[model samples]
Structures are given as structure tokens and as C-alpha cells.
Target: MAGYGDDAGFQQWASENGYDVPSGTVAAARQRGSSYIDAVYGERFPGEPAGGIEQDRSWPRVNATDKWGNAIAVDAVPARVIHASYHAALQELQSLGSLEPVVVAAERVKREKVGPLETEYMDGVEGQDALAASTPLLAAVEGLLEPLLTPVGGFPAMMVV
Candidate 1:
């Protein structure tokens, strides 16, 4: 398997967005995108192809959302589906509003975005939209993340050692 999308896919995304990013930068972005998707959706969505997600091979599913909380249409498939490391990035890139933020975040971490996406997250946002947007990693991943998250309120769990 070629393994989902790659630098080429990332570059295509950049070009379409009018950004002249390098292949390395694109690769980083794609890697980060893949890691992000895998972390959030792997347990629930579980991508096809085993190794990673194949945009073309990935089944089309409804109930997708964008960073702006807008409803992305699933009426028809496009001529080409942009596949990142995982389907999460693919879903974000498929969106109208998410592409810019993800690209921007990816560029910032250039050639090293993958690791950043894999780290622990969503600690104390408390379901605040403003707080989520302010966090770079969360902002880039909010579209896929927020939907999967459930809120827990109280004085926090306690354990005495």
C-alpha cells in the first residue's frame, strides 16, 4: 500500500490554498494530520487499510463537521479525495474553513508537525469555544476532536495515596 496521502497531497493542499510551501513542509503537515486523525478517530472510527487511512478507500460517512461548526455537505464525492496520514486530516481538508487553520498550524511546526499532534491534549478547555480556538493544537484539531469529547463537571476526582 502506498499509505494514504503524502507530501504530494500536502503540496496540492498548499497550492490550492495559494501557499508556496516546500515539500518538506507539506510532508510535516501531512504527518501531523495523520497522527491527529489516528489519535482521535482510531478508537471509534478505525480507519481502513490497517496501516493508515486511504481517502479513496475510506468509506464515506455522514455527520462530518468543520472548525467553524458548519455543516459540510456529503451529497457527492469529488473527483479526487485528499488523504492525509489519517482520515481526520482528510475530513478537515475537505471542509471549507478548516484548510486554512490546519495549513497555518502545520507551517508553523514545519517538518515537525507530526509529533505535536500525537501529544496529550484537551485538558482544561472546559468546553469553551474561545479557549479551544486559542490553543494552536486544539484549534487545528477541533473539528475532529470536539465531537468526540464529553464534558465532566465537578470538584474533580480525588485519590489519596
Candidate 2:
């Protein structure tokens, strides 16, 4: 199996075999093999700005490898873990009926305009122009999040928060 720290070797092998690896492929390989690099290297390489590459000096670097023998600097797994945890928490909050009120309020506020000011300003201009631009995004977010607040085998939970 190709372990970490094999990027250069992999690149060389790929080149010798007449394969053209793209930049994205290199980035993906680096991401996947980041853990392996962390295991080998002491979690960081020194900052060398001579090449004009903007390195995050504060973040520790891992010596990741690929199927070949190329090495890369990568962030440690703790960052990924923390990010995933935050997303999961947000998902759980959505599942627990936390975001429904905000959506309902937004819809209600848009619906309750009474005069030309409300219609022209809110609906005609802001709603039709500015807010309309975001309608697709809003719909997508609602579609993705609404189910989380819906009870299984029942109607969607009413707006409470």
C-alpha cells in the first residue's frame, strides 16, 4: 500500500508511466496523506519564505507522503476534528428545532407588508431585487435544513425558536 511521504516517488513513477497528474490531484493526495506525514515528521517544518509561498507559520506542518515519494506540509488532524465537531453540533441544533423560528419570521416579515412603502420598498425593491437574488440560496438552505426539524413519520415541527 502507498503510505505517506511517497509523493515525490509517486510523481516520478507517474511521470515515467506517462501519466499527467494535475494540481488538484496533488492537493487531494496531500490532504489524504496528511496524517501519515504527521506520524513521520515532528508535526512541523520551518518557515522558508524565499519561494514567496505564504505559509501559515503558526500552524504545525506534517510530512505527508503519497503512493509515490513526495512530501508535503499539512495541518494536523485536530483541526479537522474540531471543524467536524462544530458542524455536527450545528446539525444537531437544526434537528432540535432551533432554526425554524428564524425561517418563519423571515417569511412572515416578507408577507406582512401593508402599503406602497411596504410593497415598493420591501417587496418591489428589496424583495424583488436584493432578496430575490438570494431566494435560490435561501430555498436551498431551507430544503437542506427543514427535514432536520421535521419529526419522523409526522409533520414538520412548528416554529418555536
Candidate 3:
């Protein structure tokens, strides 16, 4: 499937926002941008893929509702998603792999001390996804998407056995 928004939409957004149009094939940039979106935020989205597990993209989710508990049309991709995608696409276009998460050996430094210096690190479970330790979601993009995402570390509104 194509990215969340069309090339024309992206161009329009970039112009209106005063962002320089990145140099690249728009289709390729959009694809990478869309893939980045899925990789970074897919699991945090409130519902399952509308087209099921094999869906090419993560929008149009089933059972996704707004923050107010209003039902979001299953057939629709919200504008926030589109705008976030566009913002991400612009980042990807500017620098390939800019939005990709980096993987590193999980550091386990619980505490360390040196002469006149000491540091203690928070403990975390091992084998966490690399994304957790890598570059965080850009603030602008996260601001646009935060309301639509399920709250991390919080329970779902309903659970079915």
C-alpha cells in the first residue's frame, strides 16, 4: 500500500510549514517514511490492523477509538496520522535512515564510582527492543500522534479473554 498521504499532500504540507522540500524521489521517501512510522509507533496504536496481521500499513485500524471514546471510522486514516507521516517522511527524505532506531548492546551499569564521581543507572529488564535505547520519537511528531496512541504502561479500556 502507499504511504499515509500522497506526494501532493506532502509537498503542500512542506511548503506551508516552511520546511525545505527534501531532495529525493517522493515515492521512495514516502515509502521509507511510512515504514518508519509503522516500525516506531505501530504497536502503540490502539487497535489491530484493519486488514489483519498481513496488512501492508498500520492505519485504518479496527477498534481504534479517539481519546474521548468516540468510535473512529475503521475505514478512515485520521489526519493526525497523515500529518505525522508527512513530518516523518520529510525527515527520512532529508537524511536516509535518520529516523531508524539504532541497536546497541544493552548496558547494565547499575552503579559506577570513580574518584570523586559516582553514577547510578536505572535497572531495566534485559532483551528490551532496541528502539527503547535508541533515538526517541521526535517531539513534534510525538505531539501530533500522542493523543491517538494508547497510553504506555496503562491498561486497555476493555479486554476480551
Candidate 4:
């Protein structure tokens, strides 16, 4: 992701969390972790937290507070888009376990879990088989983001009856 963080930021986070990760791997992991977010919630543009204005994609900067009350402000686009709140964005960068299962599942088999590209396995490798266990991992990632992603999709009394 573009503005998820820099090498220094990732290192600082890793150090604070007692985890060791390479700077280059930080970018890759962010990309993959954000990919999972996309799969679950679809693409979240800049205006998502700013007010849900779909057309205002060119904001000089956007700011949104995450569940932890941390301020999330950005002026540029990461390769992957943030979910509006800077904390959620940072969460994606901070959690490698969030992406590990996804990467493993993808490597194991070619399939779409949620918002993934609908890819069919056509490699035609006679007896090739592998285990793709990602649901549990994806659930773990979702749990990490639970407080940030609440039920905001619709009203409780939308019944047409």
C-alpha cells in the first residue's frame, strides 16, 4: 500500500510489537493484508470515512480516526487504498499473520474467497493437489478488524412488509 507506512514506520511498529520483519517484506505483507481487507469489505476509497462521497477521490488529504482513537491522515495514495480510518490502514500494515494464511491459501489453490478475482484452476497438472485452509485465518484477520468494522450497512427496520 502507498501510504500505509514507510520502512521506518514499519520497523518501529515491529520493534514495539517484538516482531522482526524485513523492510521489503513489510511492503509485500501490507499489499497482501490489504488485499484481504478488499476481499472482505471491497475497495474503500478516500471519502469512505470522510463522508462516503464517492466522487471526491482527489482529496489533498483525508483524515479518519480508527477504533483505537488514533488519528489517520494521509496525503497520497498507497498501491492499495486505505479503509478511511488511518488506524485500520495501519492495522493492515502491522499484522502479518493476517496475510500469512491468505498467501498460503492462494498458493495452495486458485480460488476466490470473498472479493477475490474469480480465477479458475486450468493448470491441467494431472494429479496436483494441495490444501487451502484460509477461512480460519481470514476469520482471525476479521477479528482483528472487528471493532473497526461494525454493522453500518442498513437500518434494522427496512422491512417492506
Best-fitting candidate, measured by lDDT? 3
**lDDT tens digits, residues 1-161, model 3?**
79998998888889999987855577777887788777777888887899998899998899998777878899988888888888888887767787775555555466899998999874433444334545446667777877888875532221111
Q: Give the per-residue lDDT digits (tens) of candidate 4, residues 54-115.
A: 52333223564345655446544432233222333344455535333333434544455557
Estimate the overall C-alpha local distance difference test score of candidate 2.
0.32
Tens digits of per-residue lDDT, candidate 1, 37-84, equal 444334443123322344433323345333345444454212122332
> At residue 155, what lDDT does model 4 achieve?
14
lDDT of 1 at 101: 38
Q: What's the CA RMSD of model 4 in angstroms?
A: 12.9
The residue-by-residue lDDT of candidate 2 on 23-129, one tens digit each, is 33543353333322222122222332222335422233344333244443464423332222222223322343222222232453444455654542233233243
Ranking of all predicted structures according to lDDT, beginning with the best and ending with the worst: 3, 4, 1, 2
Candidate lDDT scores, in order, read 0.39, 0.32, 0.75, 0.41
Off by over 4 Å in 4: 1-3, 42-144, 152-161
Better of 3 and 4 by lDDT: 3
Count backbone overlaps in model 2: 17
Off by over 4 Å in 1: 1-3, 46-161
How do the candidates rank by TM-score, highest first?
Answer: 3, 4, 1, 2
Candidates 2 and 3 compared: the better one by lDDT is 3
Measured over all alpha carbons after superposition, the RMSD of each candidate to the real structure, in angstroms, is 14.1, 18.1, 6.3, 12.9
